[model samples]
Target chain A: MSFLSVQNIKHSYFTKSTAVAALSDISLEVKEGEFVSFLGPSGCGKTTLLSIISGLIEPTEGRVLLEGQPISLADAKIGYMLQQDYLFPWKTIEENILLGLKLSKRLTEQSKSASLNLLRQIGLIGVETQLPKQLSGGMRQRVALVRTLATEPKLLMLDEPFSALDYQTKLKLEDLISATLKQFNKTAILVTHDISEAISMSDRVLLFSPGPGRLHKVFDIPDVIKNLTPFEARNHELFPEIFQTIWKELESFETFKK
Target chain B: MKPSKNNADLLHKQYVHSLKREKRKVRLYQLLIFLLFFTSWEFSSKMKAIDPLLFSSPSKIIDLLFSKLHDGTLMENLSVTLIETIVGFILGTLLGTLLAAILWWSPMVSKVLDPYLVILNAMPKVALGPILIVGLGPGYASIISMGVIISIIITTIVVYTAFREVDSNFLKVLRIFGASRFQCFWEAILPASFPTIISTLKVNVGLSWVGVIVGEFLVSSKGLGYMITYGFQVFDFTLVWLALLVIAVFATVMYQIVAFIERKIVKE
Candidate 1:
């Protein structure tokens, strides 16, 4: 069975006067330890889909399964990261990182040390006692990453986590995250609008079209590019060829919408 | 480069000095206004330019304060009013927050209570004073109930709004962790709303004072409110002024205490 499977998912948001369909007939699967990206325009419900897979939102007409069990039942096994760090400003970095473990009631001395070790491994050292406001944007986001990873989730969801950072920081974080995920042999699904980001970091890029977002096309990154770190992949010669193909496919959706 | 660094340090010192000077000037102006108002009132009363009977002199009020203190009547009344105000203030805040938590816990409850909340918040709370005294009897219970009722509705409305206004994303983070509703409230919602809650506390200090005083007025019992009423009946405005002054000082002190707690609890 696939590591994570989203089956014929459909969702809608309802208000007093309107029921807006956000996602329609969405189905996808990711192999164990695979990396995939959902590349799409705004209003594509990329986030909506991510929320569904993370079990934060229930699909109106479908289900998600992780390791062959329903995703909802697999509590605390999925880690979700948002565009901005959303670290509880009142909490110290240590508190924020341990939040997941604390919530899951698995916070032991061993687990605490393991999370702190992860923090240090992620190049954030000696910042455990400091508050989120004291850190720079990149550092805070890294703290958020540590917070998410502290739970040791089997599958990770990255919803445009690097989109809020400066270009330089974003590039560096992509490499750091790609390496970390690879080192742990974890499966990850990233949602992004940046063609280069999707092509560089993902093994397979799933292009989504907007307006009740449907999967439009899929592009499989060559092993030559996929084997490299995101930064190295971005600089690879084959990168532009794949980038152009995905960009044109995304552009077609815009023109077709208009 | 060293000389330029020294210049920067010198400029920083000058800026700090200017800030201190400005703060001192503000304090000086505040003292001047306070002194001028009382000094003018005392002078006018002494010169018989104003009705001494109606607008009692500062000296007369101070003398009455001393005499009342010596006889222990002022302490008795002041303590009664202070206790009622404090108890009422704490109860009002606690009940309001509890109501807000209930509203947050169940959206259906909030929806059902929405119109009622608006109505209670809009209605004059003091108008319930007579009814409270009649119902709870002419005692501390009625006076304290007045204090609570006066502030509770508004506190509920304000606190519930604050609870709702907490970033939905924070709740999202907690939900993804599979945290229960109670866990979410304790971990994120309550801590996030501390500032708003503290601000409501500040406003409730004044509100409870209004409630307790009016309750005392309706009941005609032992309190600063009763002192004011008695002074008015006897046409001894000095006694009225003394009671008013005491209320003002204690209210200010309560507000400052709330402010201090806000500074301590709210880091940012």
Candidate 2:
């Protein structure tokens, strides 16, 4: 059985005047420990879909299933990190990292030691004293990632987290994330407009149609290697092929001006 | 030839920009203006156009200030006013900020207190001067109460507005983590509201001064406000001007301290 399942889910928003459909009968299955990417253009409902799965937004129709049972939002195991780091500016790196644990009331001495070890593994040692504002953009995002993952959710949602960074930093973060996720053995669903990013990071990239987004295609990436990071995979012979396929898939999308 | 001419013109413009007065030079020019202003006022009073008794020549006001300083009266009065203002300001800010937090913490509390607050705020707080004196008696308590009345309203309004204006996007992030309300406030609302809080502090510094001075005017035997009133009754224009100068100087100094604190926090 799939670790998590979304079966024909629909979502809409009513703006006091009209109902606007955001997701039109979307369905997908995420296996245990799978890295999934919801790839689409800006304004696509990939984020809205992710939100529904994360239980931040309620689906209008259909049900989300976890462990072969109907999933309540409260019961949905999700760790969502957004584009903005959302690191409390006042908090130190240690405080910010433990924010999730603190909120979840799971910050025992054992978890504290484990979290600190995780931080060290992620190459952030002695950042306990530094405030989020004091850290670089890349470092802030790292702290945010740690904060999200501290709750030890079964599935992690990445919402364009690296989009805010410049190119070099983005590449560096991709490398860091790959190592951390692999070591921790976490499942993830990444939402991104960046084609190359989706191709590079994800095990399977789910391409979606433009607004009222529905999954158009699912590309099973076969470029898996022993311990290849996002930066290292750029040199793979299949890199260009995967990028081109997803590019063509996106370009074929119908564009009608609103 | 046209291009060369334009380049020459550009070079000239750049040269002029480089030669433009520095910020410190602009400050010097301001000082000069004050000196010129005082000199002119002294010249005018020296002339018979306005009576020296009525206009209070800058030189005479300086002499009056020196004499008051020598007598230790100016420092004594100023210390009393400063203490009252500081105590009142701190108390008002603490009360206002706590109340704002309570309101933010629970909608029920906010709803209950809102009407009463509006009515209290709408009434001229200055009108409460007599009541404050009656309740607190004819001492520094009356002045501190007045200052508190003025400052607490501002602190409440500024903090309440800031409290309500919390970023909902952060709330969504918190919700995803199943964060409680207390945790959300600690992590998100408090830090986000800080810039607003600092700005309110700066504004309140001035308002607190206004409150203290007004309080003094209502009832006091010492302080700059009292001195001004005494001068006004006895027809000592120079003394009145001196008192005004003292208040303006003290208020500006306090405001600068607030600005300094803001700078430190911003750096942090």
TM-score of chain B of each: 0.97, 0.87
Question: Model 1, range A1-258, lDDT digits (tens) per residue?
Answer: 878888999999999999999999999999999999999999999988998889888899999989999987237898888999999999999999999899999999999999999999999999999999999999999999889989999999999999899999999999999999999999999999899999999999999988888898889999999999999998999998888888888789878968
Among these predictions, the greatest DockQ belongs to: 1
**Model 2 lDDT per residue over B1-268, tens place:** 9999999999999887766756668889999999998888899899966788888898888898899899999999989989998888888887888878888999998899888888877877878888998899978889988888887876887898898898787887788878778877878887788887888888777878888888788789988778888888999889889988888898899889989989888777
Which 10-residue window of candidate 1 chain A scores lowest in summed lDDT? A71-80
Tens digit of per-residue lDDT, candidate 2, span A153-197: 888999999999999999999988877888789999999999888
lDDT of every model, 2 decimals: 0.92, 0.84
Going through the candidates in order, their DockQ values are 0.66, 0.44
Q: Which residue runs of candidate 2 sit more than 4 Å off their true CA positions? A: A62-77, A223-228, A232-235, A239-252, A255-258, B1-31, B39-49, B57-76, B102-142, B161-169
Model 1 pairs whose backbones collide: none
Best by TM-score: 1
TM-score of each: 0.97, 0.82
**Real interface contacts reproduced by model 2, as a fraction:** 0.61
